[model samples]
Target: MVLKRIFTAIGVAAAAFALSLSAASPAAAVPVDAPTPVKSRIEAAAAPDTAAEPRTCRARFAENVNHRLRAEAGSAILGSIPAGTWVQASCTRVAGGEYSACGLSSDFWMEVYWKGNWGHGAWGCVQDWEYTS
Candidate 1:
């Protein structure tokens, strides 16, 4: 009788474990080799225009802000914007995305024309958070 009771308890435990595993499994599982449909859809829907109308603003760079070739934080750094140098910035939304930098609340990129000793007639991108208008 004791052996039979042990066997029944073991069976119940096994069934409970199986039920827990099935409940933990995702309802719909995508194959590992398959492309992610949602990510592609989001990217397609968030594509930004390069020719969007830019807003003009005069901004002063923060103490540690540098100019970048692209709006992304990992882009190539062109040069540093000197503190107290008021730059005429043409602000535009980033293509397909937004960026935050220098602890400011804006997510736009400001294109500033580089002049003086830095580089002549070159444009650089600064995150909106890195500057104050």
Candidate 2:
């Protein structure tokens, strides 16, 4: 009977010691309403000269040409410009070398925009020589 009582006393003492240690830690004293620290990030501003000017020129497609998302021929074709369609062309020469497509050769790629049901009047690239200004 004495041995059982001694074992029960030791177990109670161990539990009390563990509880006391947890309460003494700094993390346990933090208030429940305390605000957490916040982190912020900054982004670089855009330069005025880097922005492209809104340039528009009228041109007619000599033949059907694939309107690409990028200046390169192998890029994704956003749409196709039909022959005889007058497009508002804003062209810029892509440096490297000339490219031939739609029975024309030129080093420039024109950003063609047309009015249709497509959102915001879709824009795409076509070889400069493919259309006559």
Candidate 3:
């Protein structure tokens, strides 16, 4: 009986001590010399340029032809695009390089007819219009 009473007393004292500590400890207490918060140096980059600016795309010079006068249907030719063949492409992502689809307008992808061939130029070699612009 005495041992039981001693154990009960110990448990009660422990509980009381815990309660006292919890009650006394202030979570928001500031230290005497709190360091000032550093202001962030970085700011958000300028909002994505939303205003559509008028731009001109040009055709490749005669000296730098993009495709041969009669490029084979199934070959990937590169050089410069011919003049007077400028077409507006639907702008997609314009980062370091432009990402676009061959569109008739802002949202009109065109399907070119290549004799017996069908595919897109994933390389997206920009035409002369893209270069001058």
Candidate 4:
């Protein structure tokens, strides 16, 4: 109990000090954008993808939140997935980014494609959500 109290006191003091420092900091101290190195690294990792090639991704749920693979994408969406979902792990566009699907019927589905590689996810709640039966 004493140790817990001591820790709580330390946390309160640290928070007070942090608040004071933030109040004293100049507006320009924070960078307007991400650090240059982070941007470069992201670009490098994404370099393998290109418009000329195909960007397709696919996936299958060993089991949804209900612990059942038989539960199709529609049920999966209704489960833990958020609305307006667009995860690239589940499905991909047919030709470019024109058409999309998260397996409204098919047990296995593919959502999006970037370059020659395929991505995967739960990508539910697109415009076709009504047809999910």
C-alpha RMSD by candidate, in order: 14.1, 17.2, 16.6, 17.9
lDDT per residue as tens, model 4, 1-120: 999999999999999999987784576677687642321111122313344554443223322322112223323232232333333343232211211233332232234322333333
TM-score of every prediction relative to native: 0.37, 0.40, 0.21, 0.20
Candidate 4 TM-score, C-alpha based: 0.20
Q: Over 4 Å off in model 2, which ranges?
A: 1-55, 91-98, 115-133
After superposing all C-alphas onto the true structure, candidate 3 shows an RMSD in angstroms of 16.6
Candidate 1, residues 1-133, lDDT tens digits: the string is 9999999999999999999877744645644676423221111232136535543455555444666677655667778777657766544334322445444333345566555422211112222222222
Candidate 2 residue pairs in backbone clash? none
| lDDT score for residue 101 of model 4 | 38
Superior by TM-score: candidate 1 or candidate 3: 1
**lDDT values, one for every candidate:** 0.48, 0.49, 0.34, 0.34
Q: Rank the candidates by TM-score, best first.
A: 2, 1, 3, 4
lDDT of 4: 0.34
Residue 11 C-alpha lDDT in model 4? 100
- Candidate numbers, best lDDT first, in rank order: 2, 1, 4, 3
What is candidate 2's local distance difference test score? 0.49
Highest lDDT among the candidates is held by which one? 2
How do the residues 13-96 of candidate 2 rate in per-residue lDDT, one tens digit apiece? 999999987776777677688652221110011124644655445545556766666666566776777777776654333332
Worst 10 residues of 2 by lDDT: 37-46
